[model samples]
Target: MLNTHLIMEQIRYHPIVATISIAVGTVLASEVIWKVVQYFRSKREKANRVHEVVVFNELGEICAAQHLWNTRPGSQEPEAAHCRNTHCTLRNVGKIAEQIDRAVYSIDLAIYTFTSFSLADALKRALQRDVSIRIISDGEMVFSSGSQITMLARLGVPVRVPITTYMMHNKFCIIDGVERVEEIRQLRKRKWMRPCYSIAVSGSVNWTRQGLGGNWENCIITADEKLTAMFQAEFNRMWKAFEKTEASLIQPK
Candidate 1:
């Protein structure tokens, strides 16, 4: 009994060591909690960004543009246009249709290879809506099997072809003179430039099924009037040059 009492009474706790251990434990726990919170926050922010890059649908509904790549999947990078991939999943034909459908006045298109039925349908629809529609296509491909030249011509849409030894390889469509309805979203931000029109899309995509659906391609969507003007100028130059030679060069497709 005497030995047991003395042993118990002599036993003491070290406050400094215990307190330091508790403090260290609290710090480690706090760090873990902070890391967990940051992980969730990063996920939430990424989802928001994915939802932000979007385009307007035919029915006036805003939705994320359907993007795809051919060789590799989209890089899933934040704040980028996904053009770095060899192929992109951007819904080319549909987005063009939406841009044309929203056209209040006119649409001028310069395409290298136009073979998309869906795009032809959109052009027809635009013509029906009384939008002034003009198209410039490569001379050789205009009469090809999948070419839309004949269909567009039948729809009363004026179609032109270049008559040079070199290829007219421009691929873009200008809506309402200043509406640059480009498809590829440019990765480089034009700090001096901001949006000028309501809709614009442009990139490496052609109106062909392979170009839009299958090939390794890139495109951009923008609404800058300056860019529109530049593209429109190129279209005008080509259109006029083709017209000068068209009277002698034009043939039934």
Candidate 2:
């Protein structure tokens, strides 16, 4: 049988045993301290992290003016006055434009009816900054009045339209660093990793005046790697299927 009392007495008196016990205790305390530090660091990082999913709504007093103008007979004057001050303040459109403005690498836009000049200007600025942009629009809608597709194409930005008669009514945009996102996804296949700074914006908010400002619409902006990758794949597939011949030519005004 082990002499537990005797061993304790030796440990209590022996300098070597006391030093070893203190060293072990110090190591254990250090490990616990390190673990506590890591836990708080992780918690802080999570607290300071940006939102993965952001939602924008096109409703309320902003759209109410347009609604009043359309529904009531004598409300046009007041509505017009309200609209004159508020028409340029569409938050959803501003958000979309902000995404365009922030593009460091690329922007792939697949919109149905793109008549918003502000958005078109945003694309132009991105083009000027050498950010690669590809636009795919509805074939018929590309020729519609107020459509900025032709103007964009004329500025040397690549634009394409589906050859099919059915409307290409997809309203989504894949923005920034898609290649980095793909690289991170491939890394995740082997081990866990953080998502890259790629963004995919989708929903009913078209790149049009009425869609962004007047209509009831919703937009979702996500930094989810998987979802963004899926959108990137869809955009690539549509880009391949769309006819680029009309997009390359400068249309006559």
Candidate 3:
């Protein structure tokens, strides 16, 4: 009987140790759960940063479209599969002009060489619609067979080209002027309210038909606001500079 009583006492004391072990285990488990929650929260925040808000229907459905490009057949071979395909992001000048409505308030371009009749036609259409147009290109492009500048001027498009010593090596366009205006004002009130996203179209093709549809060129469309701002500033600066200068009128070729 005495031995049995002593064994019971030991067993009773063991309960306290068991309780402590359980308590420690619960604390460890809670810590692990806390860490897991933190990891998920961080992931969600990062995802939000990269995601874009897109409107589908009248309701808001957030979506992200990364900058991508595609090339037409037979001009230059692509570096990889992503470099050439419909899945890539690209819009011809014609497509871009078609996309513009309401007001094609501004067109900022810095092409090294442009001789595309299709592209010229697109610009002309945009001007006829009373959409404000602006163009700035190097002197090399001024020699196109078709008098693009004169035609644009006849249609009242604001064309500006600088006679700087350095090459005007920019090749990009912004279709909407509202966003450019908003960005320039540094007005945060409309920061979230952007005009339809602008695309950056580029490729091996010049404005010539051979370059636009004939040659394979890589271009990407992005809703990237930062790139938009940069291009806007560049265009505005060049426009202002050219605005200060007196330009000799070119006779229609």
The top-ranked prediction according to TM-score is 2
> What is the C-alpha lDDT profile of model 2 across 1-253, one tens digit per residue?
9698977787878969868877998999999999999999878755533333333344334565454555566532222323443333344456567778877667888989889887888899998987777888887888789989888877777778867768889999888647644543475574543432567888876777677656667677776768888999888878777655554445534
Stretches of candidate 1 off by over 4 Å are 1-92, 179-199, 248-253
For each candidate in turn, the TM-score is 0.56, 0.61, 0.51
**lDDT tens per residue, model 3, 1-253:** 4497765675588977757766898999999999999899877744433212211121111111222123345643222233223322223342444444323344666566666554666776666765556677765565556646556656665566667677766666666644564553364454454333454443333554444444445444443567666667777787788774326444333
CA lDDT scores, all candidates in order: 0.62, 0.71, 0.53
Off by over 4 Å in 3: 1-94, 100-104, 178-197, 202-204, 214-216, 249-253
Model 2 lDDT on a 0 to 1 scale:
0.71
- Checking candidate 2 for backbone clashes, the offending pairs are none
Off by over 4 Å in 2: 1-89, 180-196, 243-253
Query: Against the correct fold, how does model 2 do in TM-score?
Result: 0.61
